[model samples]
Target chain A: MPMLRIEGLDHRWTGARQDTIRVGALALGAGENLFLHGPSGCGKSTLISAIAGVIDVAEGAVCVAGRDIGSLGSGARDRFRADHIGLVFQMFNLVPWLTGIENVILPCTFSRRRRRRAGNPEAVARRLLGDLGLDPDELGRKTAGDLSVGQQQRVAVARALIGTPDLILADEPTSALDADAKTAFLDVLMRDCKAANTALLFVSHDRGLEGHFDRSVDFRDLDRGGTR
Target chain B: MIGFSLRSLWNRRFVAGLTVFAIALSAALIVGVEKLRDGARDSFVNSASGIDLVVAPRGNPVQILMAAVFGIGGTGTAMSWESFEWLENMPGVAWAVPIQMGDNHRGYPVIGTDVTYFEHVRHSGGQPLQLASGTLFIEGQADGAVLGAEVAARFGHAPGTVIVNAHGSGDVSFHMHDDAPFTVTGVLAPSGTAIDRMVIVSLAGFDAIHAPHGTPDADPLDAAGLAVPPRNTRADHETHEEHREHTGHDHDEGSRAAAGTGEHAHPRGRDPDGHAHAPERLNAVYVGLADRTGVLGLQRAVNDRAAEPLSAVLPAVALTELWGITGTAERALQIMAWTVALASIIGMVVMLSATLESRRREFAILRSVGASPAHVVRLILTEAAVLTGAGLFLGIGIFILAARVAGPVLASRFGVQLDTRGFDARELAVLASLFGAGLAAALVPAIKVYRATLADGLSVRI
Candidate 1:
């Protein structure tokens, strides 16, 4: 079975007249990377929100590790996501009050399975951060809010890849940086995902960087629901 | 979880600190109210305790307590000496002692009673008045007086020192008993009772001075700021002149104590030689019964059977009713304190609820990372509990600290001892209720976080 699979999936915002995101079938195998591309307000983030179980799913099947997430309750879905998936939010979803290393190790505070798989989660976080060309010793002490935008994005990538989950979801993780910093952030993110051999779903409004992924799927191509 | 909660609080510790303070004040108000109420009752319950009934001319019983026991007001219609004897011979009466009053030495009431007062009178739960200096006055000792601790301290009359008296309650008195003098033979310890503000004398000496041709006047209250007494007779005369000059009261050829004669007498010659002469008039009589059961019957018996009109007041009943009459004010204060606690609770809830809007993205991130909805709620509730618990502890600390600081003043003013001790069961219950209130208030915010939709995963809306 593939690491991630979606079949006839549909989602709608509360009180909306029609499904806002619809996908007939989408699949990614181990080590496969799919660049999910669309412009702003194209429902790219909504699709990833469902795939990550950040929102409850009811219409159709959304599966990770061959278990349909729609079958699990909200709480179980959260556990499954934390165990099997790494999420890298675009705006650097690090707790601002914590240090860089503390944010990197936060997932271990929640999922014991991930902590066990990481084999010393702190060492794993440090290794991932160092592999991404960060000065772990220095950046580890700086609060997440104090880091530069590019540095913060790399730390987010390190946080996502710490546990070597089977899947990684990076949602425009470089959008906040300049052109030079964006390429640099992509380089670190791709390298970390390839090193972990995890399937990648990279959501973005930018389509110019499609060559780096194994495949690219546009939002309009996947979601047949009407959207401007 | 604790680390997360603490770090989160450290993020906005100023707001958290203010909230903690509000809660602490509320808790202190509640617990302090309970303490003061108990303290007041304890003080009243022990005030002038030992005697079962007070027999005085019929009037307000509470007023009798104020005047006689608390040394607060003027002595109401004096109980006659005949009535004192009549009360003594009653069927249920174990003992009765007549107390005469009308004079003051430096604002402390001068109490004239026999030596049996020392043997039978009890204070603060049957605790006898232990002497801190010298000896109690012997029955036959002429003009020898026992000073209560405060009176001695205020008037500077140690053993062997003679103190003169004024003719009325010290506040309005214009006369001094320069013709009648009291020799301080003993000083009682600070009993934290009304006796601390009185000078005790033998009944015989009291009558000897107040007998006919004993109308001399001097102001003892003038002695508050007077210089120390001179050792020689000449300096005594000088201080006496100073007293007369300041008070505008006459100091006649004062009571002469002829050293070799073994007899002291008013130089006014009211009594050529001071001798034991019981008076025909008395102010009040305190009675102790043989048993508790006959108290009401004895009260009725004394009221109905006395030849002269007299009333037997159950001291405990009068005092409790007095407290009840004033109890509404206590209840109002208590209610005001609880309102403060309620405000603290609501303030805490409002503060926590405000944080929910700012914490939505954080909550979303937490949920995305595998925290259960229960975990989300727990985080918020745990934070509330920590703050409220700390506030309660701070309240208790302030309560004890304030009491310790105000203990002496409270002792002097109200005779209410500051209860400095460990948390009693009621205090513990108050603490528990505070925590419960915190949880209840936190639940409003907790459920808000739990039911929250994670729409802005990486975006900070607030």
Candidate 2:
């Protein structure tokens, strides 16, 4: 079974501007790495939200591990997301007041499945931080707000990679990093996803980073027949 | 989650601390105002305890209570001493203490009563009066006086200090009784009642001062024939000069005449020529019933007396009635205090709402980490509970500190003793409602954050 599958999904933004997002078909197998490239405001974030169960589309089926999440209630959808998916935003991903390890282990605080799978969540969080190229000992007591931009991004990556979620969603996460730091961050992120057999749906406007993934698709190609 | 909430608040400790302080101040104000209101009524009620009835000239019952027990205003008429004697010997009457007023030592009222007044009177929950220093004045000791704690402290009077009486109750009186100065022989302990502000002397001394000069043979009990002595006389000048020499200062006199002739000058209401006299009239009388059930009957009999038009009132009932008249004002004050409390809670809501704009990104970050909208609501409610709980505790501390500092001042200045026995049920109820109101008010911001979390998801606008 694929980690995520979407079929004939359609979403209409409510309010003054009535734009629609339509996805005819999409699938990512377990452990696959797919890069989603698009221009800004091309509905890439909307698709990410749909895959993560943060939003239910107005039409169609969003299935994770063969279960259609769009059919679930709002609360159930939230639990499903907590248990099976990890998200990384562009910047300021960590709660600034929480320490680095605390932020990394936060997913387990809400999801019992994640907590049980992590097996000693604190140790797993420290190892994940160490694996992501940040010293766990140094960051253990330091708040995320005190870290450098590169360091904060690494902590965020550690947070996403914890508990070995079925899929990792990266939403232009490296947009704030320098070129060298961006490449370095992508290398570790891809390595961790591959090792965990977690599918990766990396969305960004930048096209240079598509070389690191197994496959790449433009967001415009996915929404071909949408009524703009 | 609560830990998380606390850390978030600590991150903004400066603003959170100010919010808590504002809540604490309102809490203190609310509890303090309640204490004052209750304290005032309790003091009034306790001042008349143990005495069943206050018998005075016919007039308003509350006025009679104020005049007789609280020493407030005059009774407007004086009851004959014979009436007091008659009440003293009435059936079921345990004891009756005659009270005479119309003179003051400086601004403090001088109460003219016998030693029975000290023995029968009880206050502050049936506690008997105790002298802080010297003994109670002798029954017929014309020159002897016992000062209340406040009066003694105000005038610095102690054993053997002689004080002259003034004819009226005003703070300043020019009609000084220089020819009939009374020496302080004792000082009473602080009672937190009107008694604390009185200078008590025997009726013999009170009568001698008002008696007409050289009319030794006049009927002593005749209220209509008693005359005021001329203000200026050779004896007055001689006594004033001796008083000046003895006292050193015109305003206050110390104990220079510790063994002066004032002690033995006219033993028990007599002139040097050897005449006998007694008090002619009385302002009021405090009566105790032998049996509690007979109080109403005795009160009726006193009021229905055929010889004189007099009124008798139950002290407690009269005091409560007086308090009822002022209850509206007290309730207004209480409502104002609670309004201040409500304003503080609203202030907390406004503060939380103001920070919601800045914390939108934070909420979005939590949502991305799998915190549900329900979690967001709980987080906000927990923050409100924590702030109000902390504020409640700090407010209690502030109230206790204020009560400790203000208790004695209120007792001495206004004769109101604060019940500083810690948080009572009513106060706890106030605090509980305050906390409940705080959380309820916080729901406003909580729901706002919940909706924003659902709408913004992982993509916060800012």
Candidate 3:
């Protein structure tokens, strides 16, 4: 069975009359890296948020590890997401008050399953950061707000790979980096995801990142043939 | 969780400082107001010490005490001299010192009493009156007087110095008793009593100056009063002395004697034919009881005297009753204080709520990092409590400084010393109540933070 299965997911904001999402089906096996390309206003961020269990779907079910996520309560969905899914946003959304290592190890605090799978959560964060060429001192010394753009992007990748979550959702995570930094970030992020046996769903507006992934889905074709 | 919350607050120190300052200022005002109430009450209570029973002609006891103890009213009637003697001779009578007002010497009241007043009266803290300078008057020396500390100090006078009385309350007087000038034989210690600015003289001095100028033997038939004792003989009596330099004027003995002696003195002491004297009556007397246990009994005895109408009062009870009549004013003050406190709490609430608008992003970021909505709520509440607690400490510190600085001055002026160490349970309860109210104010904003964070859900809202 695939690690994630989505079928006929649909949504609209509670107050809005128009549907924002209408997707037929999608599936990702363990250890697969899929690149999703779309421009602004194509609901790329919205889809990622929905898959992370942060937003409720208006129709159909999203299954993770063969369990239907649609029937779970809000708190249960949050717990499920925290346990099996690690999400990284385009802006490297780390709490500004927490140090780099502390931000990387956060999923383990909310999910015991992730914590157990990582063997030792703090060590896993440190090793991943070290592999990504982040300074060891930078792990403990710098808060997320204090780090540069490249450093922040690398930290976000490290965070998503920690705890060995079955799925890693990266939403335009390398968009802020220069080409050299982007290439370096992709190398470590893809390599770490493969080693952890986690499926990567990478979303970005940039087409150049497509070849690095095993599969590519253009979001424009998935949404009413919308194009950017 | 605490670490994160603290770090977040640290990053927003400007906002935190403003919130903390507001809390501190409100706390200071609330505590300061309460302290002032206690201080004023303490001063009042202290002034009432050692005064047991106060006897006055039948009327309001509150009025009598307000006038006598507080220097706050017009003269009531005086008890008859016979009645005064009767009370003083009673078994429980310690000393009955009369307070004669209605006369002023340069705005200071002239109190006519015996020397026993200075010897026996005890003030707050069991302190006795100590003479500042000179000596108390001899028992029968009607012309000798004691100056209140300020009066003597003001005029640069000691024993053997004389000051003329102006014969009335205000500085304006149609008549002056220049011939019967008061010689300062003593000066009283600073008692913070009505006596502090008084001119204390023997009771006999008041009688002598006020003695009516008429012969006791005068009959109705001797209508015109036997030719006015010869205009030439009065001329000689006036012309016998050389002129002495006086304060704003130069005057001789004739003007002095004419000004001092009023025509009614002779009629009060004698008939027109010039026989011996007769005793006139007094209106009231102040009686001090030796055993306060017997005040009621002594009052009853004094009231039973069939010879005259009178009333004896316990000064403390009378004062309490007097103050009770002005309960409206006291309530008004309390309401004002309460309004000020309420406004302060509302200010804190508004300030905290307003700042929450800017902090929504911080809360959203926190939510993204696995902090529950409840955690955000706790963080806000803790920040408020910290501000209020710091402010409370600052306010109390200011109060202590005030007490230390102002307490003694008030004590010496009012005969009542505040005990600075006397912070009772009531004060502590009031402080705790303010803190609780402040925490409640903070909770309102924290709840808003919780709701906004929940709505955003792992995404930055602002």
Candidate 4:
């Protein structure tokens, strides 16, 4: 079985009359890196949230690490997401009050599996941040709220790769960075996830970085195929 | 978790501070009311100690307590001397000490009782009577007096000085008996009781002055013909020549303390028992008891044997009833305390509820970082607990400080001591309830955050 599988995945926000998603089957092998690009309102963020088990699936199955999230309760889904998946949002989504190191260790606080996987989580987070060009002082500085946007993206990449999650969901992770910073961040992200055998679902509206990933899937094309 | 909560509060310190102050103000009102209620009870109990039954002419118990214990007026008719004697002789009676009020020496009330009073009367802690200076009245000398601590302090009277008494209650007097004055034979030590504000003369002495003396401004039937002249009249006379001549000779003669000699008495001796030189009618008696039980029985026994229409009461009962009468006002104050607490809790809820919306982004971040909804809920509750607990602690501290700073002033002004150490269980319960309600109030906002987090997914609203 692929590390993540989607079969006839469909969703709409609760209390809304219109369907926001109708996607055909898709599958990703372990350590696969895919670039998912689409126009605004094409449910790119919604598809990433589904893969991360953050949003409830209105129809079809979103299976991460081979377990269907649609079958899990809310609490179990939360725990499953914490243990098996690492997500990076368009913004860093780091707790503002926590230090950079503290924000990086937050996943480990909730998931013993993540903590175990990270192997002395602090040391792992420090090494990852250092490799991503964040100094020890930057790692100890207050969270994304205090960091520049480029720096925040680098921290988010390090955080996503910290626990070697089975699936890495990067939601517009490099949108705020310049081309050079984006290249540096992508190099660190792809290299780290590949080394840990983690599948990557990188979402962005920009197609400039499509060449960096193993496969490129247009969200509009996928939705068209699933609807037809 | 604590760090997070602290940072959240620090970020919105202004709103949080108002919530904290609201809780604190509520705490202050609740704690203050509790202290005042307890203090009033303590004052009533303290003032009513030692006296088992307050024998009086029939009236309200609270009124009787106000008059007898605190010296506030509304004189129930005096328990007649005959009634007092009868009560003292009752089967269950230990000692009946009549408190004869209605006369003033300086600003203090003049109480009349027999010499046996000194032997039997004990103060709150069972401390026996000790004279600060001089001796008790000579058993038969109706003209001798024992000055209360305040009276003694006011007049600078020692064992030998003859103080012209002020012979009535209120701020004015009707009669002036300049011809007679009692020799201050003793000064009592500070007693922290009504006695501290009394000039205790013999019942016979008080009686003598009130008798119909038939002389202008004098009661002729009174032994020794000694009546306290009105203060205004004395000031005028003292400003005149004849007063100087009288006072000069009297001062010298009284200062002569011929301790072992009765040799200075009148060269012509009159009737014995010194009825010729003693007062005719007693004011009231002071009762002392060997055992405190059967007080009601003793009261009944006294009333049945009385010649005049009179009533007997337990001073404690009367004082308790007086305090009970204030129960409605006290309850109203307690309700006010609760209302303040409720309002404060509502304020905290409103603030917390308002802030919860802003906290959605934080909650979403936390959830994306893997915090459970339960964890977020706990963080909110913890913040509430911290704020409410701090307010309660500070409120209690304020109460204790205010009571300590104002204790003596209140005692002197209202005769009620505000004891700082007497916090009751009820107050503790109120504080705990306030804290509990505050925490509960935070739950509304907490649930809202939980729902927002689930809906927002990995996306932080901010």
For residues B306-416, write the lDDT of model 1, one tens digit per residue: 477777889888887789777998889888988899999999999999988878877777766767777878899889988898899898888888888986667655656
Best model per TM-score: 2
Question: For residues B1-462, what per-residue lDDT tens digits would candidate 3 score against the true structure?
Answer: 555556766776776666666656665555656666565555445445677776777767776665555444544555554566667688988876665555567766676666666765565545777788888887646678998776777678788998777555565666566656779998887765555667877665654455322324344323332234311244323322211122123334344443224222222233222211111334335566778899888878766778876677787777577567656665676666556656766766776688677667666555554456776788888777776676677667756776678755554344334444646787788778878988887888888887887777766656
Worst 10 residues of 4 chain B by lDDT: B259-268
For each candidate, report its DockQ versus the true two-chain complex: 0.53, 0.74, 0.26, 0.58
lDDT per residue as tens, model 4, B37-77: 77667655655566667767766767766776666674545
Candidate 1: DockQ? 0.53
Candidates 2 and 4, the one with greater DockQ: 2
lDDT tens readout by residue for model 1, A1-46: 7999998878888898888888878999988899988878777777
Model 3 Cα shift for residue B308 (angstroms): 5.9
Question: Backbone clashes in each candidate structure, one number apiece?
Answer: 3, 0, 23, 17
lDDT of 2 by residue, B1-462 (tens): 899999999999999998998899898888888889888877787788789989999999999898788877778877875587789889999988889887888878888888889989999889999999988877677778999898899778999898999877777888788878898999999888899988898877876565433332333423212232212234433433443342212333334232122222323443221222234467899999889899888888988999999999998788778988888998898899889888999989999999998898898888887888999889999999999999988987898899899877777667788877776788788889988988999999999999888898878876
Docking class of 3: acceptable
Cα distance off (Å), candidate 2, residue B317: 1.6
Candidate topping DockQ: 2
Distance from true position, residue B130, model 1, in Å? 1.9
Best by lDDT: 2
